[model samples]
Target chain A: MPAAIETRNLTKQWGDLKAVDKLDLVVNEGECYAFLGRNGSGKSTTARMLLDFIRPTGGSSELLGGSGSDPDIRARVGYLPGDLNLPRTMTGRDAFNYFGGLRPSGESDVRDSLVERFGLDPTRPVRELSTGNRRKVGLILAFMNNPELLILDEPTSGLDPVLQEEFRDLLAERKADGATIWLTSHVMAEVARVADRVGLINEGKLVKELTFEELRHQATTEITFGFAEPVPPSAFEDVTSVAAVTQDGVDLVLSLNGPVGAVLKRAAELDAIRVETEQNDLDTIFIQLLSGEEQS
Target chain B: MSATLSVYRRWIRDRRLSTVSWTLGIVVIIVATAAFYPSLGSTTASIADGSDSGEAMSSLLGLSSGIDPSTPLGYLWISLYANIVPWTLMALGVALGTAAIASDEDTGALEYLLSGPVTRTQVAFARFAAAVSVLLLVSFLSGLSMVLSLPFFDLTESVTTTAPDGSSTTAPGATVGDIATGTFSSFAVALGLTGIAFLIGAATGRKGITLGGASAVGIGGYVLYTLSSMTSSLDFLTWLSPWRWYVDDVMLINGLTWDVTLPFITATLCLLIGWQAFLHRDLQSS
Candidate 1:
């Protein structure tokens, strides 16, 4: 079977600035792929290209094994843009009826369930809704059709913590039902909860691609080893999984990835007097990765 | 329903309030103008009966060769139906056309709409149809109000004509059909002007440009025609203005002419060009 979403050398340029550049990406069927990037890192641009909202300056993209511009193919895909704006006078119910009427197969029960899940008031006009409520409306519309693929950008942006949790649960449920979700987010916690694989984009280029397992085993530990005799930080340089080492007096701090077996053996060889290890969370590691503070 | 039809229905529903208000507003203007017919009828009749004064007044009021301001058709044309009614409709038309694509795009609502199963082509055509439909509805209501008030204004009496060739004749007064045809002319002219706005909106997706451009064209056309009516040197430029074709024949008194078809043709051409431009250009998302 073909990938749910695929791009080959996909590039978009506005004059000299490349919004998205030679991005070769694939989201396999039933996979939850998190596109991690900072603001203006081409995440929304890529999503727009996939939806055919803007044409790629070079190369192409496909959604559900068909051209993104094809209406029939778009029908099977649900999209939540970075910014959601609805007609001001339209009530939530009005939007549901109007957009639902356009669907090839109308499913009112599903729409209702989503509304209920999100605690959305169907009678309120869009203009009267708060930012979070507007996001709820956007989410409900995106999930109403039970689409095969969901492309969401900053999906949980305005939601409270409680609603964010609910959104994660809803995403998990959709993933369990074999839906392919491609979401772009700068929030590390949210991505950690739902992402099976993550591709980090920086300045319109894919910098790193890591699976959940790889992320779990990423360079996240900072080890502090002290010795009676002063030792250089390079003493542990040859050790596997050691990302970076910093020396202070007779003490050295090492950022490690794998088990501490090799580091311990080396420590014993160096007759280390004291040793301490602190496990770092994914966010810290992600920051270090982005800041180029961690050694390759 | 298809996405195109659904969009059309939603658009109509959204504009329902504005439609009612514009239609009612035009009605009020018609009623207020018609109330003057009772008092102004005799004064206008004397003017029509006096050849020299009538010639100067006809030219000033944009009246045709055979039209006499004393008659119901002539009074309505010079006083309300010709300039006031069409200009009011023109305001509504420019507004509707500007909002059709450009305003929605400016608000970012259009991006959300297109994200659905609807295509850009569907949106372009559906929005144009919806705007045009509202123009027609408002125009029809305006015409109906004029027709209904004819009896109250005592304008159903037959008219007497004085020819420059030393002859006189009598013709039936303005009928409901004449009022309907007159309103149709206004609708057509407004539609043509609105079509220009719609085309600009579709091509540029800028509300300000659409409104300003269409208004400039409408007002500019009228100015050109008026100036051309006085100066023969600028008369050729009147062809560029639908106002020329509109008031030249005085459809309410002279009945429908081939000139009435000009607005429809212009509107169709503008719509086609707008649609093609919209399809090719990138949507200006906010």
Candidate 2:
């Protein structure tokens, strides 16, 4: 079977600036792919191109083995834009019903259930809702349809902590049910927890693609050791890829990237005791990739 | 099957306030005119004299000296083409037609409707039809007001007298046939103005600009017609103005003729072009 969503060298340029440049994205079936990028890094532009909201200047995209513009493809795809601007005068229920009515075999009860679960008041006009509630309304509309493919841009930008957790669980449930999800987010922890594979994007280009296990393995490890006596430089000469080393009296804190067993073995030779190691989080990896310090 | 109709229904629901306001404004104007008709008739009769030159007087009133000011039908004729019907129709048409498309898009209601399975042409045609229906209804109400007030002025009574040329007077009573003719002329003028307003709305995608452009075209045409009548050298310019086809003197005195049909036909062509513009243009809800 083909990938759920595929784009081949998709390039979109506005005047002199390239919003999306030669992006090669492959979202597998039932896999939650997280796209990480900074502002003006072409995340939203890529999502817009995927939905055919704006045509790409060059290259092409396909949805479920069909053209992006095909009605069949659109019917199975649910999109939530970065900036959600709905009609202010309509009630939340009315807004959902309006969008739901566009599709065939739409379920009104599903919208109702989602609205209630989010604690959204259907009677209130959208204009009266706070920014977070407004975002909730947009989220409910995008997810309630149970679309075969979901593209959510900054899906948790305005939610409270509890609601954010609920949203993550909802996404987990959807993924378990075999729904392909393409999520773009700046929060590394959120992506680290949910994404099966993460792609780091910067300056409108995809820089790296890593699975969760590979990402964990490639992350830096922090090591701290208290020596029985002062350590000499020759004792640490065999260890390679030491990011930073600091000595406060007899205690040494070394940040390194390599086999943890080798670092421990080398520390034993120095008569160091009380060794501790912790892995670095995705934020460090992301920063390293963005600063051009990571190996390709 | 009923989904398209639901879209139209929602459009009408969205515009209910504006529709009611325009309808009330037109009705109030018609009622005020009906109330003041007696005073107008008496004033015109007192001023009517054989010594007044028909050419100079026609420039101001667009009426020939052949019309007897004592009769209500003659007054109705003057009012129909001179100022009352055209201005009323023009105002109603601009308000209704411009609000039809531009306001929907402005409020984001058009996006909701367009996202449905229905095609763009259906929405355009349905909206145009709805706006035209409102315009025609306003015309019918204005005509009804005039018809209802005909009896209070003793306009239904027949009176025979001699003209200035020593000929027997045959015209009498505010007849239904005469009222129907006036109504048809009003309908044509209203339709023409509405079609022009729709074209402006589709082209501009803005309410204020559409209404302003449509009103300018309408009032500017009337001014052009006046200028054409005064100077024989600029007579060809009259053909460009839709108002020239529904000139007060021509409709009220000459009755409904093929000449008036020209404006209706031109207006239909304009509406067709407007529909095409609406079909091709990309919709952006502001």
Best by TM-score: 1
TM-scores, chain B, all models: 0.92, 0.86
Question: Which whole-number lDDT from 0 to 100 does residue B278 have in model 1?
Answer: 90
> Candidate 2 lDDT, tens digit per residue, A1-296?
56998999999887999988999989988999999988888898888677654578888998888776565576677776665665445778777766676666578788878888889997888778888898888788788788888888899888998988888988998899999999998777877767999988887899889898888877888888888887864566567767678776787778887766777888887788788777878887778777783344
Query: What range of 10 consecutive residues in model 2 chain A has the weakest lDDT sum?
Result: A80-89
10 residues in a row with least lDDT, candidate 2 chain B? B108-117
Candidate 1 CAPRI-style tier: medium
Candidate 1 per-residue lDDT over residues A1-296, each given as its tens digit: 56999999999899999989999999999999999888898999999899887888998999999987788888888889888887878999998888777778769999999999999999999879999998999899889999999999999999999999999999999999999999999877787888999998877888888897887776478889999989988788899878899998899999887788998999999999999989887776677666662234
Looking at model 2, the pairs that clash are B81-B248
Instruction: State the DockQ, from 0 to 1, for candidate 1.
Output: 0.60
Off by over 4 Å in 2: A7-29, A33-59, A67-73, A81-89, A96-98, A127-129, A151-159, A183-241, A244-296, B44-116, B137-216, B219-223, B226-238, B248-285
Query: Mind giving the per-residue lDDT tens digits that candidate 2 earns over B223-257?
Result: 78777766777778877787666664356545788
- What local distance difference test score does each model get? 0.86, 0.73
